[model samples]
Target: MKRQHSHLTPHHPLSGAETTAAEIVSGVDLTGRRAVVTGGASGVGVETARALASAGAEVTLAVRDTGAGARTTEDITATTGNQGGRVAHLDLADQDSVAAFVSAWEGALHILVNNAGVMASPELRTPEGWELQFATNHLGHFALALGLGPALARDGGARVVAVSSSAHHRSGVVFEDIHFRRRAYEPWSADGQSKTANVLFAVEAAKRRAADGVTVNALMPGGIRTDLQRHVSDAELARLRARAAGGAELEWKTPEHAPDPEAAALLWQDSQDTLAAKG
Candidate 1:
């Protein structure tokens, strides 16, 4: 498909310039931006929201719980001194909730981050009768985007950031087995397929949204300690932790040693720039 060459999708820009998150958004203002981040209450997602808000964006986090959600909002407000942060109830696996969110929301969206996903869990399904992983990870985002497409499109230059994984390289869309039908399933394979779909979702979305200034790009957030590993076994976690601490001689960045949220904030800034240019 890369050979088609019929259209242009944004590419990853060179990163040697050392523009950190805090730097890129330092003076930039997003005071009125209606930004929504799925899974923005924890880990890198929380960091992303903090950076955006620090830069003056009105950020909202879509999460699954109310207690933790309220606390996250309070913490972010305390940290950023910006109380625009709100917690919305949204389960990617539930299209009805997404519909509700879009209906209740009435405004142009500056940014939408499809960052919430399950890494590994016993196989599950949504109320819509779709597999839990692909349904929540891809189709849910897809539905949300489609539902919000018009509102976001009104601005003539909105952006969507689909947080993809390097695991995308591990598998393509298991088209036939998307729901794991006619085949026995392995948890990792499901995770791999979901990640690949994240990438392809951008590929497909950019192709369609490029002319309208809605740019979608996927990136590897390296590896951060998040609840994404709730399904990971204790043995697996210990082994990975050992390896992450120089025991595995791994070259990838880890949450502890990786650059801070300030480090990644610039990438999002450039992404906003790229989206504006594309339109």
Candidate 2:
């Protein structure tokens, strides 16, 4: 029997919440391709790097801790038997660090996974007075992508994957009070806005870089127990689980509700201006 859903966009046959990274990349040879995975030292980032390396791609772990990155690189190489895995320092919260990492890169980049991110941390601000979550999650990745734009476009057909989250449904970018200067801080709202920014970035970048064949996309890497939940209290976690068990469906924002070219453009400009001012 054939299922019919002509009104909906079809999902990939292999995609599911339980699908592992290895299964997805199986039999796909990436020999000679170069890949970068930020926050590759832990969580889904590690799995992403491993899968890329297993397929014969030269995988670089871009992490804040060089020691952890080196260890992860070693583990991935040992497990995959792909000796091309290496580590590079990348502190997403710091502009200088991002610039240094970008400047140090050489040759064309085939794949870039902006997989590193923070979630639901207490009210914190960067040295430049920007909200911590917004600065690291959105602005940093934005700067890194802009810096690597040429490298990605060099040979054309490069891919940039932004690992966003379902949390984006909680809120959109509050442009007027992006830094939480005037408004009171709430961890989840700040995190949600950053995640929303990630999606908006992919939307705008894909359109802008279409001429250069640099593809960009954002995805929600379904719920997994990860260190990303470090900031969530035990009580909050239990409450979330209870709600889920009660059959409360999340009000997911559809693609039609999300793509705002004007908002994307404004974010791009604002990001550039913010970076310029901070630098």
Candidate 3:
């Protein structure tokens, strides 16, 4: 079978264009669409929710802090004139919370954006005994996407966007000793693994749900200073930049190699088992 590609080309109007989410969907109206943006309480997540709502989509800000979520939802509603903006509680680090959020979700979902993440934190493990970064950044979103599979499959179709990072280029999934049991726990390495998992999760989910009209994709939204870097010190940031500069030549990723079928399958199965074991 030949490879399928997106209609968007390098010469497309949005191609090579630095644009805001609101501007990108300017002409496209999403009047009846419903979207869920995790971590939509602040930073890029906030802007994303606002943009989608501005485009006439009913956007739910899934946040860990209900207080912040409510405030963000209010702000979004006030700015977009779309009263559909609402807030819901979601703590990705907790599987029970993820399940609860899914259970409370209603109606068809037009879009799901896995936008929450943590970066460069000191070695720590979640209550589930998994590495904190890997568990929250990757597995949590993995469960969220699958849990919402039915919702996403409804209402014609749905798009799932996994917000990965260029940091994935630094490392691939480390199946062996994934929790840093055998080796020393390095923050960046764990983060890279999580980001790579995000890409793989998107690829595999897209493949599995394509028959149901659900599309999944992953992207790196460039470097932006956000709450995600709360754990990193200024000195650490400088050191990170210096390390990146001295590393191998950076290569831009193309959609051509975005979905690695084999890796996708491995990740999918791994995620399923991991989640099941936790349950």
Question: Which one wins on lDDT?
Answer: 2
TM-score of every prediction relative to native: 0.79, 0.91, 0.89
Please report how far candidate 3 places residue 243 from its true position, in Å.
Answer: 6.5
Evaluate residue 190 in candidate 3 and report its C-alpha lDDT on the 0 to 100 scale. 84
Greater TM-score among 1 and 2 belongs to 2
Residue 205 in model 1: shift from native, Å?
0.7
**Backbone collision tally, model 1:** 4
> Which lDDT values do the candidates have, in the order given?
0.71, 0.86, 0.82
Residues 122-234, candidate 2, lDDT per residue (tens digit)? 99988999899999999999999999999999998899998888677666788888889999998988888898888888878999999999999888887777888999988
- Tens-digit per-residue lDDT, 1-279, candidate 3: 422211110112334437778777788899999999999998889998999999999999999998999989888889989999888999998999999999999889999999998887899888878999999999999899889989998876799999888777655777767789898998887887788888878777888889989888787776678889998888977876776577733442333344466777877887899899987
lDDT per residue for candidate 1 within 160-234, as digits (tens), equals: 988877555444555445678777876776776677666666766776788888987776676667888889988
Cα deviation at 122, candidate 2, in Å, is 1.0
| Residue pairs clashing, model 1 | 21-262, 21-265, 21-266, 243-248
Candidate 1 ranges with C-alpha deviation above 4 Å: 1-20, 238-279
Best by TM-score: 2
The true-structure Cα RMSD of candidate 3 reads 5.1
Reference-based TM-score, model 2: 0.91
Worst 10 residues of 2 by lDDT: 2-11
Q: Which sequence of candidate numbers ranks them by lDDT, best first?
A: 2, 3, 1
